[model samples]
Target: MIIADNETAIDYLYYETVAKTVVKLIRQKSKEPLTIGLHGDWGAGKSSTLLMIESAFKGQTDTLCVRFNGWLFEGYDDAKSVLIETIVAALLKERSGIAKVADKAWDVLKAVNWMKAARTAGSLAFTMATGIPGPDLIQGIGSIASKVISDPKAYLTGDVFNKVMDGAAEHFKEAAPSETTPQRMHAFREDFEELLERAKVDRLIVLIDDLDRCLPQTAIATLEAIRLFLFVPNAAFVIAADEGMIEYAVRNHFPDLPAATGPTSYARNYLEKLIQVPFRMPSLGASETLVYLTLLLYLASGVSDSSVEFKSLLEVARKALQRPWLGTGFDRDKIKARLGSIPSDLDAALQLAAEITPILTEGAHGNPRQIKRFVNTMALRVEIASERGFQDDIKQSVLAKLMLAERFAPELFNAIARDASADGSKTISILERKVTSKGGKDADDDPMADWPNIEWVKRWAAITPPLNGIDLRPYVFVSRDRRTSAGIGVAGGPVEAMIERLATSTLGITQVTKAEAAALTPEDANRVFQGLVTKIDQTEDLGKRPPAAEGLARLCGDRPELREPLVAFLGRLPVSKIGGWVVSGWGVAVEGPQAQEFAELVGEWATQTSNKPLSVVASLQLNPKSKRK
Candidate 1:
């Protein structure tokens, strides 16, 4: 069973404590206008924490809590107006029994409508009031309004402008004429304060989530809306977002700000000024990750999250999380002791969690969402193997071990797959011996001597139930079509488009393609590189240089940070299987300090006794003029 990836009010991961602390802070400062920044990375349970805080304020008559997701209103033309209208509408709905509260809400909506019309009509209304052209009349209006006023012919038509003005007149029928934007803002705030007083609400707590998912413009607009209530009494806002994304939005919204202003960046300064109290969500450690995974597996095995049994297990897990340094989690004895008896499925779950926790903790970087995703993926693979009638052959422990390599060390995983596919025996004797060997760390005499000297390889080999003589073809076949652990799927986008073009472009990558490759973010570039490597791994013949080979070389040339991974991939390739073309095709990608490493690799290839063809080719490259001069 797959775990749903949505936010819940459950106290998993011990986030309820953080939520309770935030709720207490809001209650203590309910009368004053307050803004608390609930900061975390994506999928770090920020939304779940928000739900917990809202749950804490349940059934409280004096304090009213409203939830607003900026991402939901991202498509609207004006986020600022949408946020204001949402709060007012919520207030009116809750206080419908009060006399004239609906009327006051209608007045606030009319004011919001006026603000909307003014944005469209631009400085025409303000220009008429001041009787001047240029920036002087556009002082109080925002930059967008000023642009419309500065050049009305470009942004506004005569008929559209008149319609906007007519709408404004209809909205403000009972109000005064020649009312400037600043005056309208002041009136809107005063009216909102009055509505809060009439509603008799002691505190208005607005919880905003998913601000990081919005575009730069929407994010900034929502922040601007929050600014309106900064001075109004009895209003508190809890905004949840990734601080880095918000800072990026700030930089995009104000591109002219200096990179370094005083001690911090200008973008950070803007966020600091808006969000008064900031709470950063901590990433899960190994022990906490173990507890989380164990609970999830229990849920997958039909243990209801709301049941008393689950709650008791949750308490045990939370206590274990408190002293994570002890490295103790929900072991088999603990589960049996609490539940009085362990289900057959839960026994398997405990074993899988114990086996996968070490690497998964480091691989997922202690993110709960990532850990859940890994567990879901493993469960799905196990189901697939069972569906294909090989359930007995593909044990959960063995599959978990293989998936750890697939998720963390992809290059090594690919090599193992290649070896399994090349020989019908479905076994790599060298790797089998490496994992089964019990000795000190000596790379010089290890069967995995050619593999990279990364700690992950050592840790993976040290895992229980080593693959000494298991027929891995079934496991490899089941996991063949899975996505890379980078979370990038086969979705069509700019990066995927580039990858497709580079993979099949027989004429070679063009200058436009090089520029495009150079423009990719480092993370996207790595994804593209990984995609290319996957393509190379699937190819039947390593003797010929596929178009993806050229693409890899060019990408490495564009992004030098990829050279090390490139070298590692080359080192893992079967020397006898690959062609001599691998000897020297990276024109400028291997230069500077990397050139020496390339030379050493070539020297090893030249002396290799396995493949004479590769050795001869590498030798020729080392001394090309020996035969001519």
Candidate 2:
């Protein structure tokens, strides 16, 4: 089932508590305008919280809510203008009798446009004064002025335009202006508040979402416009973004900011002045993550968050989540009882989520999006496995365990895949016993020192009881995540299954023998060869070396076209990797002149390379000519 990634439900993230607090804060009556900063990392449910906040205003006549996404207009329009126009448009749409008020707001918004153009021209003049060629800056300012002048009446009649002309006339003068900057700012503020009063909107709450996703210029434009034109009594702005991103935008917006040269106190002070109230979203802990995972799994399993059963569970869990002292009512049994016999895959997912909650939460940095991505990835891997006829063979818990390794302990996971592919059936048996073995403290003292991969395997094996004796190469083969699929390792599609079959059974290599390799079409052979190269390139430890070597050897012996690439790739490997003996033994598999050619190739590699990889093999050669390197 495809999970919805966007915010649709109010309490899916159990954010109602925080949402209520925001609602309370926004709903309070105050004389001064307020800017509430909702700060959280991306996908930490900032948008969802915003949605809940919007919901809180439903059925209220006195408040008008306007939801705006700054990212949508990043390049299409000026963010400053879009935000101003949007609020005015929303207010006009709400009260049909307020068109005149919207017209006045529109005029003030037009004045904002004039103010921006004047500033741009001033900046261009400054750049020229500093001996910097600002032809492009000049051209951009001209282009903007042209667009504004295209609507001549709006641009010409604006007092802001008159103000700009007045300022330009006194460009180099020391005399004071008829109006100061603060007076102009106050004029726009008064105009906006009058529009709200005219519309009978007691409070205008503008919810700005995805400010973090916008470009630096756009983000700053939105924030600065709200501060300049919309900061008035009975008007509030809620900005949802990661504080770091906004701070980054701030740095980019004002590159010469005082904090840029020293400590960041100036930037913090700037942010504090703009965002009067800061509300940071709390990161999910272990128990909270578990509840979140269970809810997402329920949603992914075709159960809607609006369903009565899910809502009941969410209400109880949300209360418990709000107050830890209340104790959670969302244990596994409670979830199972509420969900009532879910699909086996979802059931397995639920169990897997609980088992790996701690590590997964920590590894994912307690981000809910990462957890959802993990679940989505696991489901995709299971679907891939099922497509390859291993539907009944792989279990969800087993898949989750392997994915945990792939996601969190990547080096250790790669080691397991490399070794397990070579040893096949015996690999799992050995690891199972290795973990269960009651070795004394000495065996455990440095389990991680000599071979950390082994220690990782032991710890992993001990997590769940059902992974014993299962040949895991197929799961590893099918669980090729695209993000980590680059470099040396398993890749997706038909070749992955082919490689799994070849590497799993070392007994006579019957699964993909010489005959089978010969029968493969050229396209299929190339794909398989490339896939093998990736695995061979990633094989690090010796215990994990044979599978890649054996698979490469078997394919090279059968496909004549693969020989040169194989030799070239092997030549690049260190002496410790594709050793002289391994190459010579593979030569035996090839037979005839190819064997002698392979030996000569090894001799050539040893001659040019200083490591002398073939020294031991050269010493055992009966022909004295072989030791020439």
User: Best candidate, TM-score-wise?
Assistant: 1
The TM-score between candidate 1 and the true structure equals 0.73
Candidate 2, residues 1-629: lDDT per residue as tens digits? 55767775567556888888878887775455888998888888888888888888987888899999999888876677678878877887788765677666665655555455455443432121122324544333444355344553465456545545433322212212343344445666777777878888888888999998888888877886776644588888888998766765665565443432222334455677788889988888887888778777666656666777667767656756866534467665665576564456456556766787766776666778888888788777777877789888777777777777776554456556665666544444555666666443433334233442455455666677446567776677776555234223544345556765555447535677566777789998888787666655444443244565677778877887777556545544555445555445465345543444344444443343343545455444535576564
TM-score of each: 0.73, 0.65
Model 1 misplacement above 4 A: 123-167, 171-178, 423-432, 435-453, 483-629
Kindly report which residue stretches of model 2 are placed more than 4 angstroms away from their true locations once superposed: 119-181, 260-264, 325-327, 332-350, 387-389, 423-434, 437-459, 466-468, 483-629
lDDT of each: 0.74, 0.64
Measured with C-alpha atoms, the lDDT of residue 245 in candidate 2 is: 67
Pull out the clashing pairs in model 2. none
TM-score of 2: 0.65
Residue range with the least summed lDDT across 10 consecutive positions in model 2: 124-133
Query: Candidate 1 residues 146-256, lDDT tens each?
Result: 444466456557765654443344565544445456676678889888889889889999999999889988998788788878888999999999887787676656544
